[model samples]
Target: MTVRNRDFYKGIIKKMLTERLTKYEEDGYKYSLQYNSCTNSYCLYYTCPGEKHWDGCAAVEASEV
Candidate 1:
């Protein structure tokens, strides 16, 4: 899928996101779907609330080709 527009990525991530895969919630956000430029993929990441870093766990990713 050639996802060039913002809406397409948003829909994919929102649909594929599974709450069971996320953890950590101390203050703010708990889940995120980040775009990896090197791999050209989207990865689901979890972090402690208010923090913007990965929680040291392997992420679930989907490549775009």
Candidate 2:
């Protein structure tokens, strides 16, 4: 779908990612979706409640995720 408005696209991505992340956490996958402009895609990076570094585990695209 073509999103003419930038904010609208951001909102949709945020909403969908939030839901997906919540489901991931509930499913026992300790990964969180982080937005990366450099990669230009949403990915599941390893994240802990108080940890950093993403554990070197790259985030995958939502479709592949």
Candidate 3:
């Protein structure tokens, strides 16, 4: 995707995580951002409460992470 799109997504994720959310919930997704990211990937990751693996990452590539 274009940089503008990437930035837009990043901003949204940042807002969701920082403001919209109050606390972590089971199966409920949160947002995350990586600055100066080396991955060069817009793919997001997550951990569900009590989960050992991030196999259930909250990735959205909807133009979703």
Candidate 4:
């Protein structure tokens, strides 16, 4: 990811946790919470608006929040 992308994601993550939000969307990116049965926990999932496939997808484990 580019430096801009990295910073954007980091900022979103920080705001999400601070505001205790389950979902957030900004600047063509969407972040949401999903359950991971294998991990037996919830994770934060984000998707870049224009990306295809998983190129712009990522997850943040609940523990990381």
Best by TM-score: 4
lDDT digits (tens) for residues 1-65 of candidate 2: 12134443344346557576432332232455566777666644444445544543444444443
Candidate with top lDDT is: 4
What candidate 2 gets wrong by more than 4 Å, as runs, is: 1-24, 47-56, 61-65
Alpha-carbon lDDT of model 2: 0.46
What's the residue-level lDDT of 30 in candidate 2?
48
* Count of clashes, each model: 0, 1, 4, 0
Q: TM-score for candidate 3, please give it.
A: 0.30
Q: What TM-score would each prediction reach against the true structure?
A: 0.32, 0.34, 0.30, 0.47
lDDT of 1 by residue, 1-65 (tens): 11135554344365555443323342354545565777666665555545567663333345431
The lowest-lDDT stretch of 10 consecutive residues in candidate 1 is: 18-27
Query: What is the lDDT of every predicted structure here?
Result: 0.47, 0.46, 0.43, 0.62
Deviation from truth (RMSD, Å), model 3: 8.8
Model 4 Cα shift for residue 55 (angstroms):
5.7
Q: How far is candidate 2 from the true structure (C-alpha RMSD, Å)?
A: 11.5
lDDT of 4 by residue, 1-65 (tens): 33355445556767876888878878776677555778755555666687644344445555554
Model 3, span 1-65: residue lDDT tens: 11224564455565655665533333343434333345434444444445555533233443433
Q: After superposition, how far is residue 20 of candidate 1 from its true place, in Å?
A: 20
